[model samples]
Structure formats: C-alpha cells, structure tokens
Target: MQAAQTQRKFRGKNKAPKWKKPDDGHVSVMVLPLAITDPADLARIKRLFGSMWSIKRAVQRDARAKVDAYWTAFHEREEHGAKVVRQRLGLNREALERCAYKHLDASGHLKHHVSKALAMHMAAEVWNGVQWHLFADATGKRHGRPKTGRWHDFTRIPGRARSHTTDRKWETFRLVGTLHGHKMAYTDGGQYTVQQPRRMRVPAAPSGPVLTGKTLASGKTGTRKATWWDHTGPLAVVFAGGPDSGRGDLVLPVRIPQQPGQWARVEHFLSNPGRWHKVDLVRRRKASAPGGWVYEAHLMILGPGYTAPAVRERREQAAALDRIGGVDGNVSNVSVASFPASLDPADGAPASTEITLSPEERALLEREAKKRRGRARALERSRRATNTAQYGPSKKQARRAEQRAAKGLKPKAVTVPGGARAARVDGVPKQAFRRDQLSVNYREQRARQAEHAASMAEHHRFRARQVAREIIAAHGPVLVVEDCDIRTWYRLWGKRLSQTTPGLLIAALDRECQAAGGRLVRASTWSTALSQHCLCGERVKKTLRDREHKCIECGLAGKRDLVSATLAAFVRFTDVDDPKAAYLDTTSSRHAQIVFAQGLEEALRESTAPSQTTVRGAGHAAVPRQRRETSAPRTAGRRPRATLDEPRPVRDHAGKPGQRPGCDPQLTLW
Candidate 1:
C-alpha cells in the first residue's frame, strides 16, 4: 500500500529522484570504534555476523549462477556477450532481486539463517555486484566479472534506518544512551548501571509531525512529512531470536575520544543540521587485539554542512585567489609551476617546485618492501613444505630425472622457482594441487605481510596528501594538469610508479583544489601536447630518453618535466566539460617565455650536484668547474698527476668522462 502511494505521488514527475553526490560539501562519515569487551557479547556479535555472511554468500552465489546461465543460453543462441545477454533477458537490478527471492528465500534457504529483512538486504547488495559485471557504464567501461568472495571480504554488515509505527522504515539497529541493566547482570544477580558520557547524548524523540519543505514544478512550496531518527550514542544491533533464547540483541558503546580536538570535530558534526541515514558495522583484523579483530561503526550523516574554518580562510586568502598552477606528474616525481592569474608578462617570474620522495623516505619504503618480500617467500616455502605431494617436480624435470635413471647416471640437482631444488621432489607435479595443511608460521607470515602492506599504503597516502597541501599552499587552488592516463605509465615503469605513486599525488591535488573552492582543469594531452611544445609555441618532438627539452626553434632549454609544466600553465579548454577541446593560449604562451627562462636560470643556480638532481638530465646545461687561483705560482707542476683522492669526472653510461653521449660538449653559459 505504501509503495502504491509512492508510485502515485511520482506518477506525473518527468524524472526520477537521484542521489546527491557525497563530496559536494554536505555528506560526511564519522568512524567510531565499538567497545565490545565482554566475552559473551563478543561471541554473540560474531555469531550474528556469521549468520549475515552466510546469507550474503548464498544470495551472491545464486545471483552469479543465474547470470552465468542466462549468458550461456544467450551465447548458444546468438553469440551475445554478457552485457547484451543482460539486456536481452531484461536482467535489471529488480529482476535480479526477484530471481534471488524466488530461488533462495522462497525455497527456505535464506530464512533458515537470517530474517526476511536481512535476507532482502543481502540480496540487494549482491545485485549491485552482479550489475557491475553485466553492464557497461556511461564511459563504456565494464568491470571484470565478480569473483567468489572469501570470508574476510564479507566484513561489513549494513544496518537500516530507525523504525516508526506509522512509517515503513525498518529498524535493524538503534542508538540508545545505555543498554538494559539486565543484560549486564552478573551470575550473583547484581546489576550495574552503564552511564554514557555527556558528549555521547542521544537525541530526543520527535514530538510532532516532521515536514521537509520543497519547491514543486508549479513554483509553489510543498512539505513532505517523514520520520527522521538520530543515530548517535551506543549502537544496538538487533537480531531475531534463534534456537538460543537466552541470547538477545548485541549492544556496543561508541568510543569517542576524550581529546579536545577530536571531541570538538565530533561535536561540530553531530550538532550541525543533518540527518543520520544509516550505519555500517565493520570488522577488521588486528594482530594486537584480544580476539585478533576490531569493530568500527561508520555512521553516514547526510547534509552535515560542516567545513573547517582554517580551510575556508585559506581558500579566501590573497595568494590562493591570485595564482594559478600547473602540474606535470611523472613516474618518480611531480613538477609544479604557478603563474599569476592575470597572465601578464610583466608579472614576476613564476614560482616552480619539484616534489619527490626524500632519501630517508625512499630507504624506509625499500626496507618495508624487502621485509614483505621475505615474508612472501617464507609463506611460499611453508606451503610447499607442508604439502609436498602437491608441489612435486614439473613435467620437464620428471622427464629429465627418468632419462638420467635410464642412462644409469646420478640425478643432478637443479634450482627451480622459489629457490627449491628439483631433485627434492619424489614425483611428478599434480595437475590440480590443493594446499589444505598450512602451518602456523605460514598464517603468521601472511598476517605480517598484510599489516605491512596496509601501513605502506597509509604512508604513501600521507606523503601524497602532504605534497598536495604544500603545493596548494605555495601556489593556489586553481590548477591545470594534462589528462594523461597514468595506467599507461604503469606498463612502462611499473616498479618506479609503484614506489612513487604519481597517480595518487594527482588525485590528492585534485581533491585539495576542489576543497579550496577552486578546480583542477584537465587539459587534453592529445590536443595540447604540453611536453612536445615549448613556451615559445614551437612543436618539437622528443623521445622518452630525451629528458631535456632543448628546442632548436627558440633556443629554449630546461628539464623536460619542468618545461612541460610551464607550457601547461598556458593551456586553456574551450569547453570545460570536453577536455579534448583544450588548446594552448598563444597570448599567454608568448608572454610566459620570459618567466620560464628566468625560472630555469634560478633553478640551475640553486641546484645541487648534477648526479643528485633531477633537473639536470642528460645533455642539460652543467655548472662550470670553478678554478681556484693559486697564490704560490710555481707549485702547479702538472697538477700533481691527479691523486686518487681527487674525485673522478662525471661520466656517461658509455664510460666517456665529462661529456654527453652522441653530442658535442657546448659551453654556451659557462
């Protein structure tokens, strides 16, 4: 009946309602740890999660099987792909859910583990995954087929909104100031009252009809009445009674830090005008925790209308308002150049900077990676040692061993992959090997590797954000960057790109720019060709090995990335939505030549030794060797035949000292 009313209400509307984007400066998530220390309570929560996971897995498996069946039948008939099969069978999200209900719930498989509400929720989630595999997005990119989820992947259980007798909202979870005292009673029948902190106060219940006003198509105002709940304080995850009647709903206190700064942020977010939509209970593995797992509640608050005052002030500052920046992101480093927004040639030379991992940072990352690799190798060895029958000699190795036996020769030990010896294997390799008997050491090493990877990823994100903030602070929020695909660079420089994630840096820059009330304009790499052009408007093609942009047309010379960034400063898009329509502004480019030259000179003067700097690539201008004047005139005598203590001259890869390969040495400046 309620669904029919909703349909009738929207019958005359031209378009359906769409969800608002979260990052549009309104929605925010507050992550609070769940305090579940009681052993019985913890056991109950784990059991609840296990049930949810079982239901979710069943739904996902059934949905995938349905999709595969449809795809196979369609292909057999007309050779259609998955996407086409989905369209032909009308396998939309609703269709998938209906199928799941008919196959799983109606057949009594899902209800055996969870309630109907929870079962439907899991089915809807599975539909989302199936849709990703069976559909092409607006950009024509189809996601890879969904794989069977492992137990660890099913860590989150989503909760629904609060329930009202008059409204249709179902309350799978609720927030209260305290759990029932009976739930915490001891064996001796003594009960204790658990008082929550004042900061964690629950909102008062609604007193009257809640009406949200809106503008209708007739230009008149209308109000929609609805029930909104405040999801703060201790969370109670309600579960229906199973075979165990003693077990009840699981209640966990939300742990808000008492620290002033953190409390203030939480206070601001909660006190602001917003509606708490839902909460997600997430469980994560922690080696140091009591049970090897920790739980957190991610509360999704809508329209919080919260922004840090410092960020707003920074965006409104004179420096951020008057400057425009450009970024040239490479595999190992990022080059940034900022010019005045006015684009006047008379403005002082542009400020330029290069960002890269410091030597200490590089060493730390390398050490962590080395440790992870060692752990991985140890894990592989443990697998092979525990399950020897599964990892026997390969086909070639077995054949060679048989041949040696027939020839009456002793078996020669040969090193195989994973540093194992072929002679150690007693039989040929199994076509289908299953590693079922893993050692405790293997599990420990796997946990350690996962921890290291998480820490490394966090470190990378921190460094990337730090670099972005520094750039935005020094230059401005407005930025122009070439829309080059970073994935292509991964194919060419996988190791370097992984160590220094330039894509993460660019994403950070874009996010910071957006947060500061400015935009990161993506100029088309195909159209602008920032790297192939000079600030003087000369197009000079160069190879990947040519790290220096030495244009013959205008005699402009600088490090390739720096020069590209300088040219990017002048790129402008005719259509902001269409990056392909981007072009370099000739007037700005002509005027920026002087600024680029001055900046290049300043960089060269302040640069360190050639080997230590990225600015002076191969064939770049070198600093002059300062010859000291000798006070004692006759002591020069063939320069004492150059002792071993003296430094060797800089050399190219070809062993030619003090000269560039395949180019005559030119001393235009020195």
Candidate 2:
C-alpha cells in the first residue's frame, strides 16, 4: 500500500506511458567562432603557421616512408624489400618532404623545365640556389634563365606542412622567385607581416570604430549576445607596435659574486644576460574608444628612502642578470597586460591564487581581441594584395589561377554509422588541468617500473629459498627459522653465509633430528601451562608460586613451567606428541617401529631424577581421568594408544569450572 501510494505520487495525475518517455525540454546549441585581429601580430601567428605549413611535401613524402617504417618496425618484418626501404630511405623525413613538394608543384603548376633542375639538386650534390643557377645542362651550357620554377620558401601560406603558402599569398611578394627570407616581409615589433589572401574572412561586428558598411540584419537583435569566455585560460595579451616602432634591443644585467676576494662579474652581466624580464606594461584608461585609454607602462626599481641609486641599481641589475636567456622571453602570460588596477605589481610575496573574469567581462575582452585581430589582418591584406585587377590574364596564367582557386575547395567527408558520437551540446564541462607531475608514457612506463620491482622481489625470494635449502642439506631434512620471516633471514646474510644464527641453527638441528630415529618439528608456537583452574567438584590443579605441575594423580609434581617446555623439546625430536601421544614413537626411517608406555609419574621421574625433592604448599593438583589421555604401545607396523590411571575431576581454588587434558593411553588426538 505504501509503494502504491509512492507510485501514485510519482505519477501525479498522469500515469507513465508504456513507451517510457521523458520530455525534459531540449537546450539550444551555440557554436563559438574564433577570430584574430591586430594585423601586425598576424606575422607572429603566420610564422607559427608557416613553420607548421612548410612540411607539406616533406611530410607527404616522409609520411608514406614513416607509415611503412612504422609497420616494419611494429611487426618486426625482415623481408628484403621492407628491410632495404626501412634501413636505407624510410627514415629520411626531410628529403622525402622536399621531393614530394617539388613533385606536387611541378604537377600542379606544369613547370616542366624546373622539375629537372630540382631533381638534380635533390640528388645530394653540393649546390646552393646560385650554384644551381650557374650549373650547365646536358648541352654543357648554362641554363641561363635559371629557375623557370621557384623554390619553396617553407615560411609561407596555404602550403602543405604546418606552414605552406599558396600562390595567391606567395605571388604578392616582389621577389616571388627569390630565395631571400625578406622579399615581401615587413616587421612590427618582434613579429613579421606578409601578404595574405584578401578574401580571408572579414569581421562581422568589430570593436572600436565600425569600418565596413555591412549592417546588422533587421531581424538580428541589438547585438548577438557575445559567447561567454572561460577566463580559465591565460589572458590573451599582446605588446603593441606599429610601422613607426623603433628596432632596438633592451639589455638587462645581472651580477654573480666570485669566490674569496675576487671581483664579481657584475660588469660582464650588464653586457651579457643570464635571463630576461619584461620592463613594460599596458596602461589602463576609461576613454580611448575601443582601445579605451591604454599605453605602455615603463618600469623601474626604486630603492628605500630613494637613496643609493648605484647600490639599488646594482642589486636590481644583479637579480635581473641572474635570470636572462634560455627562456622564450614572453611575459604576456604574466598579469602585466592589465595595468594600474592590473598593475597589481609584483608584491614580492609568494605566488597567489588564480584570478577570474566574470562571464560578461570575459566576453567583452574576447570581443575586443577579435576586433583588433580583424583590423590587423585587413591592413596586411591591403598592403600585400597583387593581381587584384589583372584585367587580362595570359592563357597559361588563367589556367594557373583556376588551379589555385580549385586548391581551396573543401574535401568531402565520410561518416560511418555509430562510429563515434560528438560531444553533448549541453553538459557540465570537463575539469580544467594544471601541470600534474606524471610520466608521459604512463602505461608503458609504469609497467616497466612494476616489472623491475617484481624482478627484485623474485631475486630476493630465490636467495632466501637457496639459503633455506643449504641449511636443510647440511643439518637435516627439516629446517626451522626461529624468529624472523624467511625472506628477510636470507636476504641480509645471503652474501656472507652464516650457520650459527637462530634461523640457520634451527634448520641444521632439524636435519640431525631427522637423521636419528626421529623427525624434527618446530616448537616455535608451543605454550606452557601458567595457572591452574578447577574441573568439576572441589578438586583444583593448583599452581603454587614459582612451582610447575602439582598434579595429585600420581602423587607426582614438579615445576609446571618446565613441563610444557620439556614436552616441546620432546616433540621437537618426535613427529607428534600431546596428551594422547605420551607414549608415541617416531623414527626417521620407516623400519624403526618402536613404542614405550610410562605413567606420568614414572616419565617425570625418568625425565628428572630419583631423589629430587618435590616442592611443598602447592595443593594436590588432580587432572581428570577423562581428560587424561594415555598413548598405547605399537605392534610391529601398527601404533596403539597407551592407557593410564582413571581421570578424576578437579576444581580450581576459586571453584571455577574447567577441564584439563591428561595422559590417555588412547593415542588419537595429537
């Protein structure tokens, strides 16, 4: 009834349908478009892109060889052809790229004459561009026209590699066919700019001033809400520079104190740097249009009381010099781009926690960044554009233009059923990451480490086992390590073998016991009777202070503490002994069938001596008849239980109930 009520509550007025459907409303999906502005900065981006693009030909050529080599290496195949290719040419990534690039260009551009020369130079002959131009053809005459085909500049656009440039961008340079790196390049600050396709996507709603006449469609709202930015990433920062920027290097000095009384290397550091530091920042302002009041902030170290310029400068210089060189020299990641309020100057304190920008603020920053990038790109395109109005094109040129345009067409994609799923449009984002100290090749690396550990473990086990075997062989068949773990026992003394140690000595004693007409057994876990308690009526097996077994059964008594030990020692040389095994017989050889029966009193007499006086004051301890087990003598190959006096119940001095085992000639439980 309770469950039914719960079901009713869950269903409310509407019952769940058999189809089992849910109608949580769907969320609208948004796609973020990435944009770059600040045309000057485009060069740095281009260089990064160019460096990537240059590998096309080399990549494609080397790609096939690399694939084949990978297969060869992976499968350990040694066929002659596979071996020859892998060993000789498959690993040569650079040469393959050049060949592929040259071939692709020739096929694409139909530069027949240049292909032959390219092929010649690619053959590993010592020749530069000038040397190639001077080389004679088959007719022993200089080619004269030199390169009918231009060499790839690797540092340009639309090209394969991470950085190949297409003819559209490449042809914009004045020295289209020159080998110099600076034919059509211009510099802005530390970055460079070059001609790019004017058709590159234009900005839709740029920040600052609106340049284009393109209007926002009537149906569009005041502004499409900007994409919420995740300020989780480092700030997108850029140092400003223009055509008028000067090209001078800044020198930061550091000093090192020499040993003893020697002069320090302060002067040398002023000239040569050990590290780099950014001494400028972007200033903040509320009114400069979109750039909004911003300028570079120069930095300097101020000394206490404004005194000791030389001393302070020296200290600052020494610190700066200590940190120059080796690093990439980029300070944008540091929080210097946002100033004044951002000037949150170095507190010279410990590193702080992360900072965050609200969704709205982050969006604004991104929008501003995009706008700046768009303008920079637009300026670059305008300066480097060529053949814009090439009214009449030669038939050859027309064909080339067609091919270049065709190269830009997108490729068709193949989609498989249920192959892989795209990420969900609405879901909690995955966590951000910090630099976690971890092995790069984790699976393989960990496996290797574990294997090494296991190997060490096995080595230790083997040494321990060997030591145990040697002890057993020398002393007797049965070995006993008295106090320590077996593995530790041998590991420490494995190198310098020992025989007198408890573990080793026990092992040896076992062998001797086994050699005689007895078996060696470990007595390590044996316990001795400590105190006495009552069994049934009023009888108690009392243990007087400093006395042992005070049993009244045989009118016999001795130090009870020594009884269990003596029994343990007997068991050590015998295979089995307990209350039932009082007369038990054991032999290393199967042929020795012997047995003996003796009452506790007689056995104690034999074990001790004839005239040993028994201690007084201890009560006559009576161990019960039923609890008393006596082992029987053996007949030829058969072992039998030996019986003793009838068991009489005893009670402790306190009258608590308990039972005690005594000698029973019936040798069943050992």
Best candidate (score: TM-score): 1
Cα lDDT listed for each candidate: 0.60, 0.27
lDDT of model 2, residue 255: 13
Q: State which candidate has the highest lDDT.
A: 1
lDDT of 2 by residue, 1-670 (tens): 8887776333346354333112543222111111233444334333333323333434433444454454546445455544455445534433553564465464532232122323322322212332333345666765232221222223222111111222222111011111112112212231643322322232122124322344567543343332111111111222112111242111111112223322222222112111111122222222312222222222211111121233233223222211100000010100000001111212110010001123443455466557656655543333223212312344655565577669985443222111222224564222211222223233233334444455644553443333222222222232221122555645765422221123333343343334322334433332312123111111235533434455454233533332322232222223243322222111210111011112223232211111101122221121112111345442332312111111113323334334222211120100
Off by more than 4 A, model 2: 1-58, 61-65, 73-85, 101-105, 110-670
Candidate 1 per-residue lDDT over residues 278-386, each given as its tens digit: 6777887766665667888877777654555554444455233577667898887677776767765345346566655555556766886787688777787787777
**126: Cα error in model 1, Å:** 0.8
Model 2, position 143: C-alpha lDDT score: 28
Q: Which RMSD values do the candidates have, in order? A: 13.0, 39.5
Total backbone clashes of candidate 2, pairs 3 or more residues apart or in separate chains: 64
Report how far residue 419 has shifted in candidate 2, in Å. Answer: 22
